[model samples]
Target: MEPESGVNGTAIAEFILLGLVESPGLQPVVFVVFFVAYLVTVGGNLSILAAILVEPKLHTPMYFFLGNLSVLDVGCISVTIPSMLGRLVSHKRTVPYGACLTQLFFFHQLAGVDCFLLTAMAYDRFLAICRPLTYSACMNHTVQRMLVAVSWVCAFTNALTHTVAISTLNFCGPNVINHFYCDLPQLFQLSCSNIQLNELLLFGLGVLMAGAPVILIVTSYTHVAIAVLRIRSAEGRKKAFSTCGSHLTVVGIFYGTDVFSYMRLGSVEASDKDKGIGILNTVISPMLNPLIYSLRNPDVQCALRRVLTRKQAMV
Candidate 1:
């Protein structure tokens, strides 16, 4: 295929994704592993989403956010895994420039949405534990829906801005992306033009989209922790911690990996170790979210059991 020229007359057609492993013998194993992870991620999140939707008892603010989160997990994993699996199986690791940008767009969009959704979930927990009397009034159905909508809008806008900026860059040669997927920083490294503006925007938007939500989550949890500590009854403290424990765990895993990946933007180049970390945030985290909630949150477990029992009875 003839390489397509961008507006800058740069003859760039596609990018070669040097996938997770270069060994031909390990391709099947890697494909199987990631494919299984993808399946588990989809199945786990779908079950959570189903349990929440079917169980009327779970139709509260917390589960509402959980449903949104499950959806995001499914999306976030789906955005990258299928293409990755295809590359692994076919050994055709080349992705068209347009398709690469599309992946970048959806990946960032869903990831950003996850960050905000987790923050919203934290706020819901804060209200429930720290201000129980006002929790219902504060996090009504309308308010919950509005919070989710705002998250999507903010995430989409951020993703769109980066995609537009990335599209404008000129790629003269060496269209190989080192990571398993097409990421913004990796793309920045490949761009032949000045990337100071892109870097500034990335840092600025990173703070707004990622850092802000992380701060809010931390603040919410701090308040929750203080409130739990002040409770006179041990059972009350336990219950309060249980309420937010899953969210905190998830936040730690996600933010820990993501901050490591993005925060050191100017210091070093993208390494294979960075790709491994990326896999944690992109693949492993989504698979773990449902497991953490289902195992830690009694409500989700009971709801899932109810869903399964009903299915068996119907059968």
Candidate 2:
């Protein structure tokens, strides 16, 4: 694309992606590793999702939320991984402006929903352990669907806000994005327009999208810890703790990388660090989430066995 009359350099039509690996020799190796990761993430999440849907006995508020999370992980991985894998192999890795917007929109939307879903899952654990008597009445299917619907609405609005804001930014030149995927922070670095409002918007929504959920998860777990302590039997406490263990691990990996990425400033050196963090968030974290859940969960194990056994018997 050529520069229009009176525009500085060439009017930016597309942005080049500098993927995780810059070395020509390392690209194939890195591509294979992440391609394997993508397959594992998709396969693991689908297994959990299928188990929950197929097994009538495994249907509960916890697995309901788990299924949603699995689906989101699949979506999250899908949006970025395809482009990233392509960039690793291909010389031409320019993503058009419209494509960037679409990627940004879905990524953030899924992220927001992921956060809320984790919060809901945490709350579900809290209810099951703390308020066991009313757990069913409190978190019926209707309420679960409502919480999910609200999460989608809020996340959709947030993503739309950012996408529209990004659309208005002026990029005169230097159209190379530092990361494999089109992230808001990376986009901000290339913008010639003033981005203070954009920064404020991100900060404000970061509190809602991420901050509030962290606070709630902490608070819920605090009560959970106290309740577990009060349990008379060691076995009872172990079972209770086991249920939350996977989610807490998943949350740590997710928010640890997430906070680092968004909280820090972008730079020449930090770009590589951001890419590493992005790999964790996009690749490692998704695959680990379902594994963490299923390994710790006996009900899921039995259900998965049932699913596999049925498939094998049919075959």
Candidate 3:
């Protein structure tokens, strides 16, 4: 087909988002489900943020990073879920070119932050478990902030790489992305221009951003396991595992879904199966993270109770 949105002046303006759930019969049902899920996700993450901020008992490196993860979770889901929800019911599932790119950029940026921050938390656990005496010095306030700052910087840089690569592509007719959101692979299928180099970039950067973190997290946990095993008492082992257990669970879910979905060859067309998996990474993970990480922790629970009670009294 001739070029419709390309270097030539015939640049097509917007893209049609043919969302994951296509059935008009089921759109209403799916919309309500996803809409409620989105609300719970935002509210859950916000509660975590508030709890972390208000609870001085939780003013530590681990909770600091957990708070960041909660923020990223809220952002990552918000970036795509709203648009996907709109696509479910609206007759016109159109997203402006600029708006779609903006969504894509933030999705990558926040997701990258999520990955890096998890890795950082793993290291914090490693120090706490293996080198308890030096953990405080190694993971001081300055270092904690630095790790988070670096995560944001590195993630932002990675996102910029993807956004620039995607923006340069040409989109001819059939400017429709099949997936719920503007995922890189789905966008690749729409590009009329050569994508060899873009595919190469995705593969290279995907490994750097996703693969590297997995390796680091695994290495850190390996050391953690060894340290935990060395502890003679059962209580000692239990206590050690408790510190990192929630983080490990989150890492598994985040990486399991993301690496599987985005790590596929860019040349491969995004399938319905991929969109189904995307829900796990984007929607379910965010909703579950707060519950998994906070409700199980006594500090967060007490803080939430106190905050709620205060709000009730004020009203």
Best by TM-score: 1
Q: Which scores greater on TM-score, model 1 or model 2?
A: 1
How badly does each model clash, as a count of residue pairs? 0, 0, 0
Q: Please give, for residues 117-214, the per-residue lDDT of candidate 2 as tens digits.
A: 99999999999889999999999999999999999999999999998887777788598887889988898888777878998999899998999999
Give a tens-digit lDDT track for model 1, residues 40-61: 9999999999999988888999
lDDT of each: 0.88, 0.87, 0.85
RMSD of 1: 1.9
Model 1 is weakest, by summed lDDT over 10 consecutive residues, at: 1-10
Question: Order of candidates by TM-score, top first?
Answer: 1, 2, 3
Worst 10 residues of 2 by lDDT: 1-10
lDDT of 3 by residue, 1-315 (tens): 222443642275787877866778888888888999999999989888898888999898889998999999999899988878766656678988888888889999999999899999999888888888998999999999999999999999999999888888877757777777887888877777787898899889888898999999999999999889989999878877876788888888988898777667644566888888878978999999998887567888998888788779999
Q: What's every prediction's RMSD, in angstroms? A: 1.9, 2.4, 2.5
How many steric overlaps does candidate 1 have?
0
Candidate order, lDDT descending: 1, 2, 3
